[model samples]
Structures are given as C-alpha cells and as structure tokens.
Target: MTTKLLIGLDGQSSGDRALSFAENLAKLIGTAELLVVYVIEWSPYSFQTPEENAERHKRREEEISTAMERVVTPALARLEAAGIKAQGMVRHGNVADSLDSIAAKQNASQIIVGRSTETGLSKRIFGSSTANLVMGANVPVTVVN
Candidate 1:
C-alpha cells in the first residue's frame, strides 16, 4: 500500500518550504502519495443572527473558493509537474485540529508543516499551529523551516 503524507500549507513561503521538503521525502519513498491541505482559521463558537449567519456562510464559501484557486490548485500543479502522485484540499477550521482530522481520515503516516512566518505577541500568547499539532497529533509531524 502506498503511504500518504499530509502537507499543511499556509499560502506563504513557509508553505513552499514544507512542499519542497515533502517533495524530496516523497521522492525518497518512491511509492508515497501526497495530500496537500490548506486550512483557513475558523471558529464555531460565534453566535450570530440569521442574517449574520448567512453572511458568514457566504464568506466561508468565498474563502474556500479563493484558497482552492489561489493556494491548493497551484500546489497540485507543482506536484504534478514534479511527477509526484498528489491531491489537494481546502477546509475551514482550526488549523491544527483540521489537519489532524484529515490526517486520520486519510490514514496518512506523517504530517509535514512549515513553521509559521509570522511571529509576535499574538503567536507567543496563543502558540503556533505547528506547536499545537506537534503536541496533539496522532501521526508524526515534521516541521520544515
């Protein structure tokens, strides 16, 4: 059976590095396939009126469309060009949780994510998605710089 690698992309240079590392690792593994995933941070706790909920749903659709178009599609094309067997996904959720869920669903053996490019008081206070995933994931997570 072909092993799968889940690559979490942030639509940034950090994501590019993760892809590059996964590409090389996949090349080494020979029969490995990749699933590239981009997660848009979203929360389910917000309370909203009917109209507000409708607008939120619309914005969610827009974000998914934009992520699939601007981030996931290009990554898939790059993998194809590199002759790697791969697919892509765009989802809205907490990044770490979403990635871990997808990893379980897909039966991926490992998850690869680049360290976040952004750093400040917010990141320090809340911790990064990578840190969260590394702490909570069932599958092994590889962090690419």
Candidate 2:
C-alpha cells in the first residue's frame, strides 16, 4: 500500500520549510504520496447581514479557488517537479480540525505543519496551529521549524 502524508501550509517561510521537510521525508519513505492542503479559515458562527449570507457560498468558492491558485498550485508544481506523486486541496474550516479531517479521509500516515512565528498577544490568544494539530491529530504530526 502506498503511504500518504498530509501537509498544512500557510504561504509563509515556515510553511515552505514544512513542505521541504515533508518532501525529504516522502523521498526517504519511498512510495509515499503527498497531499498539500491549504486551509482558508472560516467561522460559521459569525453574524452576517442577509446580503452577506446570500453571497457566502459564492465567496467560499472564490476563496477556495484563490487559495488553489495562490498556494496549492505552486506547491503542487514544485512537488511534481521533484518527482513526488502528489495532490493538493483548498478547504475552509478551523485549521486543526480540517487537517485532521483531510488526513483521515486521505488515509494519510502522518500530518506535517510549520511552527508559527507569531508572538505576544496573537500567540497567547489564538495559540498556534502546530500546537493544536499536535494535540488533536489522529496520526503522527511533524512540526518543521
């Protein structure tokens, strides 16, 4: 059976490092398929005007397309160029939950993400995606610095 690895990317330098780490690990594992996932966060509980609610679905699709073009597509191209069998996806949800869902759905053996560089108030308030994944992931998680 082919092994699969799910990677979470946020279009940052740390994300680039995570992709690099996952790529090297995939190479070492042989027969491993990489799935690069870029998540655009959305909160369903937010109050919205009727017009905004009416356009929410369209906005969600646009967001996914934008993420694919701006993030997933380039990452996919690089992975393909490196000769790694790979695929990509754009989803909207909480980061940790989305990654876990994708990993379970794809039967991924591992989940990899980058350590966030955010500090101070943001770090304390929002915590980090890496930490959430480490705490909640069903599979092993690798945090690339």
Best model per lDDT: 1
lDDT of model 1 at position 123: 80
Q: RMSD of candidate 2 to the true fold?
A: 1.2
Provide the lDDT at 85 for model 1. Answer: 99
Predicted candidate 2 versus true structure: per-residue lDDT over 1-145, tens digit per residue:
9999999999889999999999999999999999999988787788899999899889888999989998899999999999999999998888889999999988999999989766788668878777888999999999998
| Ten residues in sequence with the least summed lDDT for candidate 2 | 116-125
Clashes of 1: 0
C-alpha TM-score for every candidate:
0.94, 0.94
Residue-level lDDT of model 1, residues 28-136, one tens digit each, is 9999999999999888996779988869878888889999999999999999999999999898889999999999999999999999766898689988888999999
lDDT of each: 0.94, 0.91
- The backbone clash count of each candidate, in order, is 0, 0
Model 2, runs deviating above 4 Å = 120-122
